[model samples]
Target: MDNCLFCKIARGEIPSRKVFEDEDVFAFHDINPARPLHILVIPKRHITSLATIADTDTLVLGRILAVANQLASENGSPDGFRVIINTGRIGQQEVQHLHAHIVGGPEPVGPMLKRV
Candidate 1:
């Protein structure tokens, strides 16, 4: 995983505009954002995708969602927001590490929910 970009970010080897972090997860602003408010929430531990998550990682995933909710509320997206997890190459997951894209603020393009 040494070449993994997200792992580098989580390890602080690569600089990122971090919004939140804890022992289990890290949330940072996306370098190439698609929306006004776009952040990527990722687990400190490396997991290729949702399809590869282990049972023990369930709690960590749940925590990621909770953190996303908190961030959205704090960022004035109390009404609603979008959370997306692109699974594989066909899904447009450029990065191998599992992460959630939390996007909101301003006028969102197209439908709020669209399969990646």
Candidate 2:
């Protein structure tokens, strides 16, 4: 994961608009946001994607979700927010690393997805 973008950000090799960080997790604002409040929460250690997670990865995974509310409220979305974790190619995952997107704002984010 040396060349991984998220790993770089987690290690401080790349600069990001960091929102929250702890021993095992890092949260930051997305450079290209889809919503007024958009943040990416990732694990400090690299995991290819949600599809690749092992049992040991559960703690960090849960930690990411556990902080979503606080991160959303502190950054902008006080009322509520949406947490999305895109997996592999079928999920339109832009990055290989495992991460969850916290998206929301003062207004509703609209429909979760267009009807199929």
Highest lDDT among the candidates is held by which one?
2
lDDT of 1 by residue, 10-85 (tens): 9999999999999999999999988777899999999999989888998999999999999987875676789999
Q: Could you tell me the lDDT of residue 114 within candidate 2?
A: 94
| Candidate 2: tens digits of C-alpha lDDT, residues 1-116 | 89999999999999999989999999999999999999999999999998999999989988999899889989889999999999999999999999899999999999989998
- Candidate 2 to native Cα RMSD, angstroms: 0.7
- For every model shown, the clashing-pair count is 0, 0
Q: Score every model by TM-score.
A: 0.91, 0.97
> Local error of candidate 2 at 3, Å?
0.5
CA deviation > 4 Å runs, candidate 2: none
Residue 115 miss distance in model 2 (angstroms): 1.1
The 10 consecutive residues of candidate 2 with the worst lDDT sum are 67-76
Model 1 clashing-pair count:
0
Worst 10 residues of 1 by lDDT: 106-115
